[model samples]
Target chain A: MRLVISFIAGLVFSAGLVVSGMANPAKVVNFLDFSGSWDPSLAFVMIGAIAVASIGFRLVGENSKPFSAPRFDLPNRKDIDRPLISGAIFFGVGWGLSGYCPGPALVSLVLSSQAMLSLFPMMLLGMWIAKKTA
Target chain B: METLFTPWHSLFGGILIGSAAVLMLWGCGQILGVSGLLSRLLPPWSSSQDIKVRVAFVAGVIALPLLAMVSGQVSSIPPVNGNPLYLGLAGLVMGYGTVRGNGCTSGHGVCGISRLSQRSIVATLVFMATAAVTVYIARHLLGWI
Candidate 1:
């Protein structure tokens, strides 16, 4: 039962990436350009996700807890300290450079583009370094 | 329609993804985090029970679009190419990120933050920031543009 659900979720998530235009490197890069054609598609994607998640959150909260695990897994910190700022900066920088955030990037993989080819390796390297340092 | 990627459509898409995440989390008590299932491709990292859930999760994700296509909800796919290197790289980054941050954007950004998790907030911020920088360097500074 759970297996069926997971596969469906992944399919929906991946398909969303495709439908939202997040999987398009050109569109993604254009969004980051900010001065070129300035694609705001990613913003739409963000907004769409936030809206759905917000409503879904309320519904879920009202209903029984869904997963076998805890309802919510809260993080441990609250400060707007160095880690927070640095991480944000890093993430922004990466988005600007590669146009491949984690979600869309995975979706892009389904397409197999040159940009993804060049960018994904370094992205992994960055993640690796971060893990090691932490 | 202003094409699909317009603000309205994007917002609608995000809503769908978020709603899916929320529904899955609430109904199944799972986080709807993609990284967990993707990581299951590895033998040591995955458990027997985890495999079942992972399969279902991934299948569901795929099915939604196919169903939509069948029902004519969406007209066309985003696009596709035959570039294995690119696919491999994307996979690698996603896999590594999952390991490093203990979650991906879906895990931390959507699910964790929705739950008011401090760690998820931090992790989500990092994921976004890193992605931003990566784009800047590749397209603007690095001439991959």
Candidate 2:
């Protein structure tokens, strides 16, 4: 049951990515290109997502455990440190350069294009390096 | 003021994303953090049980786009612009950064902020500000992307 729900959730999330034009690297690049032909569409996507998620979090707070799981497995870290900032900087630069974040990059894999071929492997390598170092 | 404002699609898409997050939270007791999930799938990171669910979720992500293409709901999958070398480099950096930061846009920006987490708020701001600065440098100054 949990797996089925998660699959459905992932499916819906991908659909949302496509429908919102986020799956398009061009659209994302335009959104980030504030000095150029800026596209504010992605902002609406963020706003709409946050708003609904806020309500969802509230409802989830009332429950001790999730519907199928034993307990909620949410992040609990509260410290502000170098890894946090530096990591964000790296992510930002990458996002600005390629306009593809983790989600979109993974979703784009279905296309099996040359770009994804290069990007995805490097991404995995990056993650592996980070894990090894940490 | 409306040069490229896709208000409806963005909002509807966002709502769908939020709905998915909520479903994940309620149904599976997970946060639906993509980078985290991906990282866990690598080597000896997470348990088999956890990996099973993660695989299922990832399958869903991959399968949906293929389905959309088949049904003609989505015409073309957009490719990354600029040099492929730089694009690949960017992916490498982003992969490391997301893992180091412990979250990405969806995890911190959407799920974290929704829960009013201070860490998430700070992380989101940092990334957004950095992204803006990076864009300024890359697009405006360097003009290499």
Best by lDDT, which number?
2
Off by over 4 Å in 2: B1-3
Worst 10 residues of 2 chain B by lDDT: B74-83
lDDT of 2 by residue, A1-134 (tens): 88899899899998888788788877787788788878989998999999999999889889999998877888888888888888888888888788788888878887535678788989988888888887
- Report every candidate's CA lDDT: 0.58, 0.83
TM-score of 1: 0.69
Where does the lowest 10-residue lDDT sum fall in candidate 1 chain B?
B75-84
Q: Provide the TM-score for each candidate, comma-separated.
A: 0.69, 0.95
Consecutive 10-residue window with the lowest summed lDDT within model 2 chain A? A109-118
| DockQ, all models | 0.33, 0.69
Writing each residue's lDDT as its tens digit, candidate 1 over A1-134 gives 54555555677677667667775656766765553456777777766776677667777777555555435432455556554455555555444444455666555443543445655565556565555555
